[model samples]
Target: MTDIVLLGAGGHARSVLAALALSGDRVRGYLAPVASDRLLGIEHLGGDDVLDAFDPEDVAIVVALGSTSSTALRRTLHIDAVSRGFTIATVVHPRAFVDPSVVLPPGVQVLAGSIVNAGARIGEGALINSGAIVEHDSVVGAHAHIAPGAVLAGDVTIGEGAHIGLGSRIVQGVTVGSGGVVGAGAVVITDVPAQTTVVGVPARPIEDKRMRNDA
Candidate 1:
C-alpha cells in the first residue's frame, strides 16, 4: 500500500479520502491552509510548507482540489508538487469502471461511479468526477474537469484546462477548446472556442458580464 499525502481539505478532499479508504491506501495526512471541520478525523499537516519534511520518493501526493469555474489553482498545486520531486497519485475509485485500454496519467482522479470506456485517454491532473462518463476514443486534456454526472460521447476531445459542468453532455466528435467552460446541464453540439464560456441547451457562448465589468 502506498503512503499517500492528500493535499487540500475541502469537500472534494473528503470525497478523495473516502475513495482512498475504499482503496485501502495508507493516508499519512492532509495539507491545507487551515484546519477544516469537514476533515475532523484526518490529521492536518499544516500548509504546503510541511511537504518539505517528507522525502518525495517515500510518499505519493494526491491533489484533492476540485474546480468548477477554473482549474488554475489545482494545476499549479500539481505542478509544484511534481517540481519538488513528489510523484502524483492516479486515483481511481474501486466502484468506477475504467476500460483496460484507457490510459490514466499521473494526478488523474476517477471518482466513484464514473465510467471511462475503451481507448479513452485521460491527461495529467484531470478529474473525472463522480458518475461522469467518457466514451470510447475520448480524449480529456490536462487539468480538465468532467463534472459529476457529465457525459462525453465517443471520439470527443476535451481540451486542456476545460470545465465540463455538472450533468452536461457533449456529443460525439465535438471539441471543447482549451480553457473553455461548458455550464451545468448544457448540451454541447458544436465545437466550443478556447477560453469561452457556453451555457444552456445546445450550448452557446454568452458575453461574460463579469469579465466585461472587470475591464
Candidate 2:
C-alpha cells in the first residue's frame, strides 16, 4: 500500500479523492493551508510546508488541484512533488476506459467516462477529464489537461502542460503544443503553437500571457 498526502481541497480535490478510492490507494489525508478541516470526511492536514513532517521516503504526494486555462500551476505542483522526494501516483477512475496499449505515467488522471484508445501515451501528471475521448495513436504530454467532453482524434499530439477546453474537438494528426490552451466548444483543425491560447468555433489564437501574473 502506498501512503499518499493529497494537495488541494476544492472540487478538483474531490474528483481526485474519487479516483484514489477507485484505485484503492492508501490516502493519508489532504493538505491545504486555506481550506477547511472537513473535506469529504478526510481531515484537512495543514500547510504545504508541513510536507516536512512526513518521511519523504515512505510516503508519496499527489497534487489534487486543477489546471485552468493556465497550465503553469499544474506544472509547479508536479515539480514540487518531485522535489520533495515523494513518488507521484497516477489516479484513474474505475469508470474510465483506458486501453491496454495506453501508457499512463505518474500523477496522470483519467476520470469517469473518459476513453483512451490503443497506442495512446498519456504523460506524467496529465489529466483526462470526465467524458473526454482520446483516440488511437495520440500522445498527451506531461501535465496536460483534456477538459470534459473534449475529443482528440487519431494520431493527435498534445504537448506538455496544454489545456484542451470542454467539448473541444481536435482533428486527426493535429498537434497542440506545450502550454497551449484550446477554449471551450472549439474545433481545432490546425497546429496550435506553444504557449498560445486559442478560442472560438475553429479555435484561433486569442492571447499569450504568463499564467502567474495574468490572473
Candidate 3:
C-alpha cells in the first residue's frame, strides 16, 4: 500500500480520508498551518516542515483542500508540492462511478456518489464533488470544480478553473469559459464567457461594467 500525506484537515479532509480508506490506500498523516490534533482518526503532522522529513519517492501527497469558488490555494499547493519534488496522488472515491472510457489525469478528485460517463477527459487538479454528474463527451479542465449535485449534459466543455456551483445544471454543448461561475441552482443554457459569474434560470452574467473596469 502507498503512503499518502494529506495537505489539509477540514470537512473535505474527512471525505477524502474516507475515500482513501475505502480504496485501501494508507494515509500516513495530514498537515495545515493550524489543525486539530487528529482528523478522521489520522495523526496531525506538523505544518510545512513535515513534508521535508519524508522523501518524495517514499510518500505521495494529496492536496485535500476544498475550494468551491476559487482554485488559488489548491493551485499554490500544487506548485509547492512540485517544488519539493513530491508526487500528488489522484483520488477517486470507491463509491463514485467512473466509466472505463474516461481519461483522468493526476491530482483529480472524484468524490462519493459522482458519475463520470464515457468519453470524458478530466484534466489534472480537477475536483468533481459529491453527487455530481458529468455526462458523455464532456471536457473538464485542469483545476476546474464540478460542485456537488451539479450536472453537465453531454458534450459540455468546462474550462480551467471554472466553478459549477452546487445544484447547477448546464445544458448540452455549452462552453463555460475559464474562471466562469454558475450560481447555485442556476440552469445554464448558453456559453459563458471567461471570468464571468452567471446566475438565474437561464444564467446571465453578473456583469458590472465598473467592476470589469476596476481590473
Name the lDDT value of residue 6 in candidate 2: 89
TM-score for each prediction? 0.96, 0.93, 0.93
Residue 96 displacement (Å), model 1: 0.1
Q: Residues 31-142, candidate 2, lDDT per residue (tens digit)?
A: 8887654476787778888887888777788888776687777779789878878787778899999999787888888998999999999989999999999999999999
Task: State the lDDT at 43 in candidate 3.
Answer: 78
- Candidate 1 displacement at residue 158 in angstroms: 0.2
Candidate 1 stretches with Cα past 4 Å from truth are: 209-215
Q: In what order do the candidates fall by lDDT, top score first?
A: 1, 3, 2
Error of 2 at 55 (Å): 1.4
Residue 107, candidate 2: alpha-carbon lDDT: 87
Q: Between 1 and 3, whose TM-score is larger?
A: 1
Cα lDDT, model 1, residue 170: 99
**Winning candidate number (lDDT):** 1
